[model samples]
Target: MSNKATHASGASSDGAELRRRNVPGESNGSAVPTQAEVDNKKSHKPKSQSSILSTLDEYEFLIAPLIFTFLAFFTRMYKIGLSDIVTWDEAHFGKFGSHYIKREFYFDVHPPLGKMLVGLSGVLAGYNGSFEFKSGEKYPEELNYTFMRLFNSAFGAVCVPLAYYTARELNFRRPAVWLVTLMVLFENSYATISRFILLDSMLLCFTFTTVLCWARFHRLRHESFSVEWFTWLFLTGISIGCVCSVKWVGMFGTALVGFYTIEDLWNKFGDLKMPKVELASHVSARVVGLIIIPVLVYMFTFWVHFLVLENSGPGDAQMSSLFQANLRGTEVGKDSPLEIAYGSRATLKNMGYGGGLLHSHVQTYPEGSQQQQVTCYHHKDANNDWFFYPNRNKPLYNPEEPIEYVGDKDIIRLIHSQTGRNLHSHTVSAPVTKADYEVSSYGNTTVGDEKDHWTVEVVNDAASNDWTKIRTLTTSFRLKHTSLGCYLRAGNVNLPQWGFKQIEVTCVKENKPRDVYTHWNVESHWNERLPASDPGSYKSPFLRDFVHLNVAMMTSNNALVPDPDKQDDLASHFWQWPILNVGLRMCGWDDHIVKYFLLGNPIVYWGSTASLAGFFVLIGWYLVRWQRGYQELKPIEIDQIHYGGIYPVVGWFLHYLPFVAMARVTYVHHYYPALYFAILTMGFMLDWVTRPLARTHKTIEWAIYGVLYVVVISLFILFRAIVFGMEGDNKQWRHLRWFEKWRITD
Candidate 1:
């Protein structure tokens, strides 16, 4: 009954035949059958194949999934582009797509795949990138954003068929497959969300397809390198790249595939009869398909990203001077510091949480410290400029001189270049993180007292490199206050608008010496009398820029605080997502008729949730009984129930659980990936329950199928206005609010 043996024996027709062809249960892929069972099956075979019930089964199996898939497409596409006004995220993402069309540079937090496709769809549809894409901006009669929405809708439409196929591959019977497909198709929230210019629908499509591809791969495992096997594997890799390109959320798909690959390989390794080289071959092939190919495709999206975006936009402020110089429309200064030296004007960047430039401003923290605020800003600014000076006041000294370089343990003071204030710290508590000391530009004079003296420690040093010597963009350093022993901290916390919304900087000592928050780097160097190179020559290496961009993005994501104006005001927690605790208003909340709200069909949503619980209860009962020796199971049973059913559960958790941990605001749309798995689990449970009964009354299976389908269709009929748009004040909206959390009433 072990899954290892099930995988070994159940995948082959020859292995099943070795047991017996004498009973229907023999080939069920779970257990062997007795002689009586075989005789019973033989008696029923003719009636099951030719009787009225059998005929009904065939029509349902062959026609229902397809019909539901078509319905899913139509329901999603009917007047899909009805709303031309920019919805919540449309202004930003739509504008990003326009930037791509104009070949203009901009920065976004996600991987390039989703936005790149959006931009490509716009270009193909003849959008000229002239729309300003301002939030709440009404679409002009001449401007068409329909094609981009249509592209996402088309992909979103694929989820229904993919669900059907994936369930079918998992051995769910016709009734179960139909239920699964319809559950996805009739979901109200998916219907409304997919029709908008957003990435969620497209991401769900790719995520669902990736799971389906893996199911196909599992089914073809016996074929080795056969066309079906290779094709499924290739498709899985491509979808991983696609999903990952869309958002980092796709990493869960990559993880699901990765974990399954390892398990599959473990099973392969246990096959003693298989040649040893077969394991090597399997690993090598998967490495190519899963790792190398996906990575190349991921990089290719960036290649296209860099290719299309040449002109600089608002994003230039976040990048290094060297990176900005490569962008069009930016003035590149044609000078470099002779060499980093004492009295050199330098921008010291905090290589801490999120990596920001050490910045100061006239604004004060206002509350706790109340001194002039010192913080780390992600963008380039003159406020970030500072002059490096010796801690002990001597007439100016050259710590940057090669012969007399600043080395490790050197005491130094940094003077704010703009305000001529010395960088100083005090015993006052920081405004946000009270335990940490408040760091600010306190003294007016360039000469520093004890509080202004900081010891510079070279981070990446050997016998050859010194701490006192400064290099731009090459070396990293840590500044420790010589008096209090606290290290400079860029905790990646945000300050209020008074501080220009930069990262909060404090002074705190840590138990460990390698705390990343204490590190710093020189971002820009300015000195006269040294040879000047082309502004472009000092640019960080191309590879470094790519790494830097990703690092900056990760840092930004980690520090993302919700903006009331941008994120949905009705953002739901992960717990609320599954039950439809709250619905996001798409647009038009006033008394006007014909409004859109993103809410899922409760029948499908709740059914999926119940199915998730049912899977555990149903599967756990059989598994526990078998494990406890109270019952016996056949290889086919193990294959059908455990091996087949456990995956979607794993996938459901993989997709759903992370949302609970995310710091970013989440909406109901986030549950769609988990919903796919829930639907599959529901289908499998229905199939497992009704399979044996099909030979007898056919009543249990058909009755449940009829009721679920009828309910879903009725819900769809009642909620037609949710997607197509209807008057918000209508009684229909009030009726749709099953719970106060639904917020269906405009």
Candidate 2:
């Protein structure tokens, strides 16, 4: 009975297989399809006439990026060489690039990677670094200015396609990607800044690439640990380092990535199905890829920076005495004594980062003590030289007296070598810092009072503190007024014009032991009794040099605040940038000279800002609906809400909001990075509003897109002259200026 039941089931299965295949089985058990099956398949296949269109549709991503990149290149490259003269920031950055070509070390508030690239461009173009690069001066006829400008423009042109790819990675629709690309390609300010040899274009390019790589990495979260996943994670890390190496503003992009990674890890931690080992692997991967990789890449850029710039230049004075001593062609510490003695004639440098040499001039202070002016001067001159002498109660400093090395807790008097006056302090209030006592040079070397006495207190010794003797450039000490008990300090405050606008020297009543402003070190010692120090002893460690340079950069950046005494017509407020309320003239305003304006295309700028506001409104509306128990969002919709809406919003905030607290002078170009994020938000909002219409009302969606494209294109064309460089009278651009605040013309 069992055998008969099995036979029946086998026969039924064979009948069902035959019916499904509609063909006969061969001896090898492979089905032989009938001619009709072949015919049916052929009928469904695409014809040769439509095959090309199908292939194009399949590779829309590649084709679209290529098209946008070509357009971006055209816009950025058009007439890039028209301005043969050094424009606004070109005067500064071009000189920096020359320093690199000459192998001369220089200082700047920004990082070195961008300027290094600029120098590379100049080197490739056979530039000799002969031109002074003065503002508004014409370039040398033999110089290859066009090639340098073209190199920088390449970075700006690539930004358009980077925005396109970033949008595609965010799952934006085709039209939205086009919108973002067009906005970046046609923006006037971006194009203008790229046409000159400046750092802004490189900064924008790296920033855009960073966001693109980050978006790609975020999408691979579900496939963690896969080859493609790890590839994107590493790329994102590299992009972060490159962006930061260009400018510190790149920190904003890094912060955006950090915020996302934290949220992602936190979410994964809550998943009950995930194994403990897997979670640990995820955390480890992020630490290696995001933290370690970026740090290494950032350090590599600085290493290259130090390697290429080996010779000392104008920036030598800005660095510590020990750091400068390591540079070739520097006179610092050459033929100078190692230890400072009572009769040593030396230049004292404030230990604070970005501080200057202790200086005094013959000019008397207009206020307070009306004594010879004592200030911190960045430049070196005879005025900076001072002679160390004994206190008034003790015998005067004698070169013959058994070489008495200046030691800790020793009473001394400092006399100006040129002015023949004693470094003096009094109870009068300081000129700038009212709470502090006044510091001035008073009394001659031959005649002085007790007010000139100062007690030396050693703060730190680079080698060892066992020896009480002070060493030049290695020991930091403080000068305490013997009578007033105030510490002699030189803060960042600038004195009035009467005092040569140098840093204010004052005596602080409170004793802050760690205050770097109060710390001083002998930089250039000239004592005949003491022997010269070993040159090898001045070698600065890389880590210490790196940290010290960064602190100096920060100090210099902070000193860029707007001056109350003068008005800067080119500077703009942070709020004015979003609204397009002002613009800057990039060169000479003469009627004959070519002029360029740093202003955005109004339609793109205004539209993107409005989209930012609309995003917040949409979020509020959704929260209200959800609170009332309406859960209408699908899985895809939720994903779009986060990646397209929340991500770019956070990026916009990170880049723009920090400027609100910045005390430095800002310009219109400062807003371009944040503008990139706003453009993304605009694209998302446009897709959000137009997507539903495409399914239900096709004609209305097409009409809306047509209007948008026309408006964006028309506005770009109207203000195109401003970017390409305008000439003739100011009235010629009157029609282009919609707002009075726009300085497109005089």
Best by lDDT: 2
Q: In candidate 2, how many Å is residue 397 off? A: 2.4
* TM-scores, one per candidate: 0.83, 0.90
TM-score of 1: 0.83
Steric collisions counted per model: 17, 0
lDDT of 2 at 350: 87
What TM-score does candidate 2 reach? Answer: 0.90
lDDT of 2 by residue, 221-256 (tens): 666898878998999888889889889999999999
